[model samples]
Target: MQRYPMTPAGHLALEEELKHLKTVERPRITQAIAEAREHGDLKENAEYHAAREQQGLSEARIRDIEAKLGGAQVIDVATLPKDGRVVFGVTVVIENIDTEEQQRYTIVGEDEADFKINKISINSPIARGLIGKSEGDEAKIQTPRGEVEYEIVEVIYGE
Candidate 1:
């Protein structure tokens, strides 16, 4: 498996989720399964079926998180020298050239990307276009809607 880049915070988040799944959810589901089984009639027991399904989904998520953590190369942006360039875990402010709308986004790992929180995945088109760019640089992104241009206004490293 190829190792991929992840911010230190993103890596920690995944580890925390894995820990919760293994230590809390796993045991809770096991108890639920036992209770459902004790009710008898495994084939017709709706609770038993639901509990088993939940167990499968939870286990799958746990495995996925584990694999990602194992292959993660955690990077701490704060330790890196500030060069005013866009990099992983750096929050960037950009202004849309056409609408003059400004937005702030932090480039992060795929697993940690949440558009609602303004965290974009490094592999995303916008992030890819912004990488290696410094403040005052223009970046052209190929979005699903169409091509959009943005001017870098700031590059922030620390939280």
Candidate 2:
């Protein structure tokens, strides 16, 4: 099985979601299905069909989360050496070589990436270019806007 590299928080988030799905969503869907079933005429029961579809989707998500959790290899950033090199679970501060703009990005697992929060996937083009690079190293990454060069300003081990 391919192991998924994730931060400790990412693993915990997935576990929390799975718990919510099992404890909250599953029971709610089951209750909805039961209530719909009581309405009779199963063939014409739209509520029953909707509830069943929702149940299927919820179950599928639950299985996906479980599989992801099983494959997860959680890495604690705090345990890593605070070397200047960028690696998985490190927050890298980069300065745009051309635009002179600075941005902070935390490299994380695919499921934990949220651009709005500056959490980028390890597989992302920018992260790929930044990985294994030390502070002050220049990385040229290909993006939708074209090739952009950035200078690594700092590599942070933890949040």
Candidate 3:
């Protein structure tokens, strides 16, 4: 399987989620299933069916998380040299050339991408355009809304 890049923080988050699913959620679902089965008449039991469905979903999620963790290659941005260039796990500040809007985004793994948090996937178009670029460099990205230009203003790593 191809290894996926992930920030150290992202890897920790995934590990925490996996632990919760395994230790808490899994036991809760198992208890629910046992209680539902005690209701009797499994053929027409809605509660039992629902519990089983929930168990299936929980198990599937656990498997998915495990797979992601197994394929993850955690990168600690803090240890990286201060190159003043945009790289994976680095937070980049940019200015839109047209609207003159300023924004910050942390380039992260796909699974950790959250637009609301200003954390973008490294594979995303904007991150792709900014990768390996230094501050003061201009990047042109193609979006569904059309082509847009942005000038890199800063690159920050750690906390």
Each candidate: RMSD to true structure?
1.1, 1.1, 1.3
Query: Can you write out model 1's per-residue Cα lDDT over 1-159, one digit (the tens) per residue?
Result: 968689988888999999999999999999999999999989999999999999999999998998898899898999988999999889999999999999999999999999999999999999999999999999999989999999999999987
Off by over 4 Å in 3: none
Query: TM-score of predicted model 2?
Result: 0.95
Per-residue lDDT of candidate 3, residues 15-53 (tens digit): 999999999999999999899889999999998899899
Task: In angstroms, give how far residue 50 of model 3 lies from its true place.
Answer: 1.6
The whole-model lDDT of each prediction reads: 0.94, 0.95, 0.93
Worst 10 residues of 3 by lDDT: 2-11
Enumerate clash totals for all models, in the order shown: 0, 0, 0
